[model samples]
Target: MPRLNAGDATRREAAGHGPDFLEALARGLAVLQAFGPERRQMTLAEAARAVDLPRATVRRALHTLVTLGHLESDGRLFRLTPRVLRLAAGYLGANGLSSILQPRCEQLSAQFGAPCSAAVLDGPEIVFIAYGQPARLLNLTTMVGLRLPAFCTALGRVLLAGLPEAEMEALLQRHPPHAVTAQTELDPLRIRRRIARARSEGFALVDQEAEQGFRSLAVPLRRHDGRVVAALNIGMHSERGTAAALREAVLPTLRAQAADLACQFL
Candidate 1:
C-alpha cells in the first residue's frame, strides 16, 4: 500500500472538523496509541494498519515522531519511548481528585485486604484513575487507565445513580441491557429500579456482571460543591462471600470510605 504524507494523515483525522482544527496533531497522537504491550514495535505498514491510516501518511508522521523522541526506530522496527510517560504524567499531576482519592482507596484495601479502585464516568465506561491492590501478585489486569462497561459495574451504577432523572433515563434508553452473565440485568425497567435502589441505599453492589466470579460494591464520591465527580469501589471474587453475606460485610466499608473521600473533595 502507498504511504501517506504527514500532512495528509493530519488532514484525514480532522476530516469533519473546521479548517482551524488541529486534526494533524490528533492523528499523530492516535498513531502513538497504536503501539502497546502486545504490539511494542511496528513497521510503517503495521502502524498504518493499526491506526487505519494511509501508509504514506503514517510514514511521515512516524518520521516526525521519531525525530521528536516520542518514537524510536532501529531501521526495521519502531517503538515508543519513555517520553510518552511524561504526557500521561502531566494529566495525572493536574487531576487533584485522583491524588486526593488515592489514600482513601489505600485505606479501603487495608481494611478489607482486597482490591479497591476509584474511577470517573467517561462516555459509557468507567475509567480507573487511582486504585489499591493488596494482592499485588494477583493476575488482576484492572489498573489506572483501564476502562470497563458502566452498566455492568458497581462503580458505574453509583455514577448513574447520581445523574439527573432526564439524563439517566436517556442513558437507560440508549443502552437497553445485554447480558454479561446469567445474573446481569437486561430490562431497562429493572435497571432503573436497581439505580433507584442504589440511590436510596446510598451505594451499589454488583455481582459477576463484567466477568464471572468478580463482585464489587461502590458509592459515589462527591466533590466539595456536592457534585458527584467520581465513584469508589471495593472488589473481590464471589467465592469470598455468598451474595447476602457480601452485602452485609463489604457494603458498609465501601460507603464509609466513599464518605471519607467525599469530605476531602469538598
Candidate 2:
C-alpha cells in the first residue's frame, strides 16, 4: 500500500457530499489518483488500503474504471491506461495555457541552457502545467502534472506570495511545511517572511531547498489587471551559478515572458 500524506488524508476526510455530489465518481477519481511514481500498480487489497476504503468498494471502482478503458488489470494488479490522459487533454485543449507557454519555455530553456517551467498553486502544492528542457541531461526531471510542496519551491513561493495574508496563514496552518532537504525552512515565521520577500521583490530564488544541488528562480504570472494566476521559473544546478548571478541573468527574461503571457489571460 502507498503511504498517504497529511494532504491526502485531509482531502479524503473532506470528501463531503451535497445534493449534487456524486460519491461514486469521487471514489473512482480517488482510485486513479492513488497510482503514482511508486504505486504504479496495485492489487485490489493494496488499492483499498491506499485509499483507506473497503476492498469490495474499491473493487467496484477499479473494475468500473477498467471497463471504461481508463485502467487495465491482469486479474491481480490494476494500473492506469493511456486513455486516462484524455482527461488532462480536455483541460489543456480548452484552456490553451499550455499551448501558449510551451514555446516560450522552450525558447527560455534554449537561451539559458537550463530547464524552464510554469506552474499554478493547487491547495498546498504547486502543479507544473508546462515544462521545457535543453537537449543535454540534468539532475532534475519534472512533468506537466508534477506536484511539489508550496513552501519550499521557488515556483511555489511566487504563487504563495499572491495569496491574501489571512488565507496564506490558514493554508500554512492546515499543511505545515516539511523539510525536503537540510536547507528547507520548516519554521512557519521564516517561511512567511520568505513569501513576504517574494511579494515585495516580485520574484523568488530558492537554493537547494527542493532538491540537493539544485536552485531555482521564479516570478509570478499575472493578468493584465495585475492578478497573479501562475508562476514561471528557471532551474539549474547550484554549481552552475550563484543565486545572485542566476537572478541577475534570468530575471529580466523571465519577467518579460511572463508579461507577454499575462496579456493572453483576462
Candidate 3:
C-alpha cells in the first residue's frame, strides 16, 4: 500500500481506525483545493507542489477533475470550472444554518461596524460558511469558502475545542502551529493548553494571532444534542480597545448569539 500523506493519515487516525480509507479521494480534493483565488490556473508542477502530493497522483486527479467538468485545463495549466461553485453553493444555499445565522451576524457586525462570520473546522483550517458584512467595513479577505489556519483564529479554536482529545491531538501533529505574526503563539504545548481552556471556558479569544490589527472572540455553534457543529465569531479592529475591554464590551453579546445560533438545528 502507498504511504498516506500527513493530512490523510491524521484524518484517518482522528476518526479512529478506518482501514479502508480512500486515499485517492483525499488527494483529489487536495488537488482541487490547490487551485485557489491567488492561483487561478496552475500547471501540473505547481499543483503538485502546492498540495505536496506526487506529480503522478496529482496528474490523475487533475485529469479526472477535468473530465468531470469540475476543472478546465489546457495542456499546460488548470483552473477550477464554474461548477466548483456548486460545492460552496450547496453549503451556503442550504436553508438551515446560513439563513438562520447570517442575520444575527449582520446585526452584531452592524453594532461595531466590523465583520462577523460563522465557520466550521475543516482539518487544519477553519472554512467560512457565512459572513456578515457591514457596508463600511467589508473585508475582502473573508468570504464564503475562505479557509485559514486553525491554531490562530478564535473561530478555529472554538471549533477545535469541540473535537475529541484524540482527534485534536492527531490534528495538531499533522498541522504544526507556525507563527503567522510576532504575536502568534506557535508552541505546541501552549496551544494544547489553550484549547483545553477554551473547551472549559466555552469560548476562545484571539488577539492578533491570526492577523495583525484585529481581535476575535468566538463561541461554539452547537446542535440540539450539544455537538459543536460550527463556530460564531466577531472580528473587531483592535485599535478600538484592548483585548480585555473587547471581552467586557462584546463577549456577552458574542456568547448570547453563539448560544442562540444552535436554534438553527431545531
By TM-score, who's the top model here?
2
Clashing pairs in 3: none
Query: lDDT per model, in order?
Result: 0.82, 0.89, 0.87
What CA root-mean-square deviation does each model show from the true structure? Answer: 5.0, 5.6, 4.4
* Clash pairs (backbone) in predicted model 2: none
| Model 3: per-residue Cα lDDT over 153-215, one tens digit each | 999998999999999999999988988888999889999888998999998999999999889
Number of colliding residue pairs in each model = 6, 0, 0
Could you tell me every candidate's TM-score relative to the true structure?
0.79, 0.91, 0.84
Q: Which ten contiguous residues of candidate 3 have the minimum total lDDT?
A: 136-145
Tens digits of per-residue lDDT for model 2, 1-266: 45566875566668754345555788888999999899999999999999998888899999999999999999998998989889988977877777888788888999999999989899999988888899785446558888999999999998999999899889989998888999999999999999999999999999999999999999999989998888999999999989999999999999888878888976
Cα error of candidate 2 at position 234, Å: 0.6
Winning candidate number (lDDT): 2
True-structure Cα RMSD, model 3: 4.4
* Residue 248 of model 1, lDDT score: 84
